[model samples]
Target: MDTQSITGATAAEIADSIRTLHERGELRAGDALPPVRELATRLSVNRNTAVAAYRLLAQAGVVVARGRAGTVIAGMEAVAQEGYAAGSVLRDIGTGNPDPRRIPDASTALAGALGRPVLYGEPVIDPALEQRALEWVGADLPGRDLRITVTSGAVDAVERLLAQALLRDDAVALEDPCFLASIHTVRLGGYRAVPVPVDVEGMTVEGLRAALAAGVRAIICTPRAQNPTGATLSPGRAAELRAVLADHPYVLIVEDDHFSMLSQRPYETLIGPEHRRFALVRSVSKSLGPDMCLAVAATDPETAERLSLRLSPGTTWVSHILQRLVLAQLTDATALQAVAEAGRHYAERNAAFAGALTDRGLPATAADGLNLWLELPLEAKTVADRLMRRGWLARTGDEFVLGEQRSASRHLRLTVHDLTDEEAERLIDDLVDASR
Candidate 1:
């Protein structure tokens, strides 16, 4: 098969050609595809047709974009996983995990959580859990016509929310340097992701306007303690975003407040009073435990109805036992206190690490989450290699980046909240040395 023979006029035809090439063993894994402009010129098609073709291949996991490195056939590990790497000897400051000691003990709650046996025809959501969730999410929800749906996790809720409102290739706005799961979800779902940049005050007004102008059908935002950067939405910024969104009333807005119980920042939402389509999802995965896979999705009545279609009987539904268990923990006074204390614990550790970095002249800031988003003066990979030599494993910011920002990513998202005083001090010293 001649490489020059790879040809097609339409995006779908081009994608099919590549797939056929791969199937026939002419294109192997890690094979480089032609640059978009060059491919467009060769195929006598519009440049955008070539770009869309590559995007189709990417969404189907047939290829991957590596920034300036260009696009290539992807291996199995294209999607990044969270938490510790398997069988690693280095001190891991990159695993974005909560302190095990902080996760409230569910054993006692579990014993009582198993209530009466639920039949298939029964309501999916536990009644007690529904009331508790109503009180919890209702406090912050702007619209009064809120309906709750329980899903496996925040990720599940986001997936369903997007599925309910969007079709394949529809534009959806997502934060640049977004959460790994969100990036994977959008790509795998075959939706075009419009990157909205985040500053210290959360998503930028200009970026959101651009995405709206691009006709995004949906938007996913993190109101407080946004991942990687820990960028929280200021009241002023939230108001600005709401105003921008006011004109596009029907655009589906999904807020994943993953750090709801653990964040020290105040909750500020983008959903204004007149916003018609919105979903506010909060999960116990962070505050309770990852094993406790349950999230309360407070959504507009119509979206709830549409999302409920997927959660119908016999197909899929969150276990009532799991819901009851989470409710027990949520209502327990002692467990509530533990969650609060864990929030303080994370804040203190991150702040101390930030101070250490500042004293060493790195000048990092610890805002309001379990991780510190440290911008390095040196390239992330260069500094990561140095850190590796010193027996530390760190995640670079590029892994979380989307769109054109990947090449310029020089930040590292470090989970140092679980580090002890001695380990923290040594890691800080090692980081300062690594940057040099």
Candidate 2:
């Protein structure tokens, strides 16, 4: 099959032609696609048009760009599974979930939201909710022209934001040992993930520069309580990142503050005053409950306009009831107190667990978030197997790695907040033994 002969003038037409070729099995996985210049010349189209076509194909998970090596058909990308395995008898510490006991009951909030009928063509965001969100998120952002938009959750907001700004096959900088949902979102969208190594002070400066050099068009960063690593951005680190990003003003930078209300650490950001494209997302899933399915997205005017297109009436809008419920929960004095208490509980429990592990010579620390990221002496998989034998389930660090080939990761992300003192002690003992 001669893929070089494939031709179309427009991006859609070119993308369709290439997709058809793949669907018909003429171009299988790993088959090289014509370079942008060659394809443009052959089809009598501009080079940008060919680039756009390849990007479309990439967004559709059809092909991947390999820099100087050129673009090639991509194999199916893997999506990580979240939550717990069904019917598992083992104590599942791997599930990165907030304690059910801590999630505030929304019965009263639901009752309040049911007072009015929300009809179609109404405002996408409730007026009161929008004002409250603006106040809450605006105080933390560095620039003016901040616009508030609501989405189902952080994952949904990220998907829409990326879709709005980037074409498929466009490189997106993501943190190594990233959140599972972020990893899944990037792969499913067919965007090539350029990894930026994250440290105790959040994303590394060298890593961001490297990703930028790789021509990454967007970046997804967790400002605080970064999943798996639980790394928060230090003021110094945030300033350095902002300085690096200043040169790349148009790169879409998304900050997913998923642990917003639940984090003990203060919020820091990479979006500078002059940065053109940026978004900060805060989900209430951890504080209220995952079932709330609500997140507040604050972005620049243009990104907000683009995001609103998908959220416009007659297509899809967040249910007004859910919005009201979230608003009610946030506004209610009693609920706010409960949320504060929940935050402290998570911090204390995780800190206690980490301290216990360290005292036993394990050298662990719960920096922030619902889980403790422990570095093991042995390979994670080996320790995982040993843990399974001890009837405890944990998530290995390898599942969160991107663009790196380490022989093995000696890390595990375990949620120890809900465990009792005895339970934690037993698990710690088991972990210590497993690492040996």
Candidate 1, poorest ten consecutive residues by summed lDDT: 1-10
lDDT for residue 237 in candidate 1, whole number 0-100: 99
Which pairs of residues collide in model 2? 59-168
Query: Which candidate's lDDT is highest?
Result: 1
How accurate locally is residue 184 in candidate 1, as Cα lDDT from 0 to 100?
A: 85
Q: Give the C-alpha lDDT of model 1.
A: 0.91
**Model 1 Cα shift for residue 355 (angstroms):** 1.1
> What is the clash count for each candidate, in the order shown?
0, 1
Runs with alpha carbons beyond 4 Å of true place in candidate 1: 1-77
Clashing pairs in 1: none
The TM-scores of all predictions, comma-separated, are 0.88, 0.88
Report the C-alpha lDDT of model 1 over 1-436, residue by residue, as the tens digit.
Answer: 3357677889999999999898888988888899999999999999999999998888787888889999998665577878898899999888988988999999999999887888889898888899999999888974478899999999999999998888777899999879988998997787888999999999999999999999999999999889988999999999999999999999999999999998898999999999999999999898898998999999989999998888986568988888889999999999999999999999998998999899999999999888999999989999998999999999999988886768667999999998888898899999998998
Residue 64 local lDDT, model 1: 80
Question: What is the lDDT for 413 in model 1?
Answer: 93
